[model samples]
Every structure is written in structure tokens, then in C-alpha cells.
Target: MDVLIVDDEPLARERLTRMVDQLDGYRVVGQAGDTASALGAISAQDPDVVLLDVRMPGEDGLSAAHQIGELDDPPAVIFCTAFDQYALDAFGTDAVGYLLKPVRAEQLLEVLEKARRPNKLQRQAKQTEASQSSHNGRSHISARTPRGVELIPLEEVRYFIADQKYVTVHHLKGEHLLDETLKELEEEFGNRFLRTHRSALVSVQHIQAMERNGDGHYQVRLADTEQRPPVSRRHAGALKDLLQKL
Candidate 1:
């Protein structure tokens, strides 16, 4: 299996590379010093597994792992860090293993033996399960676009409207169709978004005003767009209460 080692220490990287090279089937494909270089290497090499460090200069490994998970076919991540405190957090991601610094040859081999890339279906299932169980929620939403998988930051999103089986993500750039239900979106992003109607969930941060239209129906106006998603009578009171807090 191809492996990528990410560590700020060159000596540490060399040691891990030597250990991986000693293994019968695994080989070190590349090495990165920081999360930015690591991401670039992953894009260039597409390694089967990544031995990542927890802390670095810029973006930490945990945050990098989240972005890596957004990829359509992400490599298995095996954290190699000195801190044991981040073990629980590491497992929260799609990590296959977690080895401490000064890793033993035996431990590396054992972890590598079990590290295997998950299929697309398995990945999707794991992502769904993780989203359901995670309390902190995600910072970005992923969609499969015609070009490739696009990672849309949640801050850019205006609202999510249910369209039959799919949910349309209306964001600053444009709309992207997602194969998710409004219920799942609500469960994952309830803290950031509010349910304006049965078919729509609007961003609480983007809501500018709530006013009654000519027909005596309530509607919400969001920032950066002219679209006014109707507020259902059942949810209008809750919307008003939330708006008052803002």
C-alpha cells in the first residue's frame, strides 16, 4: 500500500519512512511538513494511507482530517502524534489507527496491516453515521458536482430547500443539489439554521427581517439575496422569537 507521512520534524519523517519501507507491501510515497503541503501531496499522489501528526504550524491535523474526509475517495488516516489526549478526537474522524510518537516498528506494522481504504458506499455510510452522532457538527457541507466533489463552507450557505427526495443548497455562489433530507440537515445543523417552513431551513445568521406580505403570510428576507422563503404559520411564532433574540 502507498503511504504518505506528514510531520514537521524531518528526522521523524525519515524514521517513519524507513519503517514503512522495511514492510513487505507498504512503501512511502511522499512526505509533508504541514497540513497545507500534506493536502497538496494527497491531491498529487493519492496515497492509500496517510500517517498524520496532530499538531503543526498552521491548520492542525484534526482539521486537515476533516477536509480529507470531504474528498470523494479519501485515504485512510493513521495519526502519529505524541499526545494521547487527542486519541478520542482522532477516532471521531475516519481514522484507522493512532500511534504515539517514537512509534515502534511492530506497532507501525500492525496498524498498516489493518489500514485499508473504504469503498465509496462504505465512506458515505460512515459519513452519515458520523454526522448523526457528532455533537460539534461540521464546518462545511460537501456536494458531488459535475467537475468533482465540492466542499461548501456552511457560512456561505443561505438556506436548504427540500425538493422531493433531494435538498437544494442555496449558497452565495449558486445552488447545488444534495442527496439529503431536510430532517437530516436539521438534525446536523439545528444550531446554525432555523426551520422557516416544512420545505425550507434558513440560515439564522443571514436572516435580515421577517415581515407580513400582501396575502397576510409571513416571509423571511435573507442577506445577499432577494429570495424570500415563506414562513409557515406553525413556525412563524418560533421564527419571531428567534428574530427577537438576534
Candidate 2:
């Protein structure tokens, strides 16, 4: 089984790598010092399990785990932290194992075996439970690209336009094609994103103004983007009310 070790400390990562190397079937695929790098590694390497650290700079491991859960086929997470207080929170994320710092080789092997035991049905059940209980939504949206998985921060998103099966994410850097439906995006991010039309969802935080075109159809003008998604008659009233508040 492939394993990725994530920790801010180089020594910690080195320790985990050595332990994983000693295992018969497991090999260290990659190592990361922070959550961002860890996520990028996961996308590129597609490891079977991740030895994640609970606390780190920028986004913590818990938040990272939440985003990982959003992936279609996420690797099993095994949190390795110095503090035991995060045990409950870690388990709440459906983590396969939570190993305390200065992990013993035996404990590591045992948790790795435990991580391999869950079937698809069991994993799905745990994920469903975690989603229902955890009110916090995803901080970033992930899309698979030719290079690998690309993560777009919610703050950078301008709008999402649906065209058939794919939804194009308009963000600050550029656009990315996402394998998701508008309804799913709407349901998950209704508060931050306003449904301008059946085919589009605009970021409320990025709305610059609402205007009518020459044909007298309303459209939303979002900041930092030229694309103006048309406002459907059905959703126009709600958009107007929201614009008033903004």
C-alpha cells in the first residue's frame, strides 16, 4: 500500500517514512510539510493512506481532512498528533486511525492494517455520517485537470456555469471544468453563492452590480470577471432582495 506522510516538522516526516519503509507491503510515496503541499501530493501521488498531522501552519489537518473527504476516492486518513485532545474531533472526520506523537512501529503497523480493513460500503456510511453531523462546508473546490487535481479557494470563485454534464468554475486565476451539477453546488453553498439562473450560481461576495441588457434581460455583473451570467425570471426577485442587503 502507498503511504504519504504529512507534517510540518521534517524530522516527524522522516520518522514516519522510515517506519513505513520497514513495513513489508507499504512504501512511502511522498512527504509534505503543510496542508497545501499535502493536498497537492495526494492529487499527484494518489496514495492509499495519509499520515496527517493535526496542527500546522495555515489550514490545520482537520480542515484538510474535510477537503480530502470531498474527493471522489479519498485516501484513508490517519492523524498523528502530539495532543490527545483532538482525538474526538479526528474520529468525527471518519479517520481510520489517530496515533499519538512519538508513534511506535507496532502501533503504526496496526493502524495501517486497520485502515485497510474498511470496505467501500463501510467507508461510504462513515462519510455520510460525517457529512450530516459536520455543519462546516468545504473551504475549497477541487477539480481534476490534466495536470492533476486543482484546488480553488471559495473566495477566489466568481461564478459557476453549467453546460451539460460539466460545470465551469470561473475564478480569479482562470476557469476550471468541474464534474459536478449546479444543484449539488447550490445545495452545498447556497449561503455564499446565489442562484442567478438554473444554469449558473454567482458568488454573493463577488457581486459588483445587477443590470439589464439591451434586450431588457437582467444579468449579474461580478467583480474581476467579464462573464455576466443571465438572471432567470424565477430567481430575479430573490437576487434583487439579496443585492439590496449587500
Count the clashes in each prediction: 0, 0
The prediction achieving the highest TM-score against the true structure is 2
Give the winner by lDDT. 2
Residue-level lDDT tens digits of model 1 in 88-203: 99999988999998899999998987784443324444554565577587899998899988989999999998754678999999989997777788768766777766678899
Q: What are the runs in model 1 whose C-alpha is more than 4 Å off? A: 117-246
**What would the per-residue lDDT of candidate 2 be over residues 40-153, giving only the tens digit for each residue?**
887666677899999999999999999888764568899999999999999999689999999999999999999878733354345445555663789999988889999999
Per-candidate RMSD, Å: 17.8, 17.0
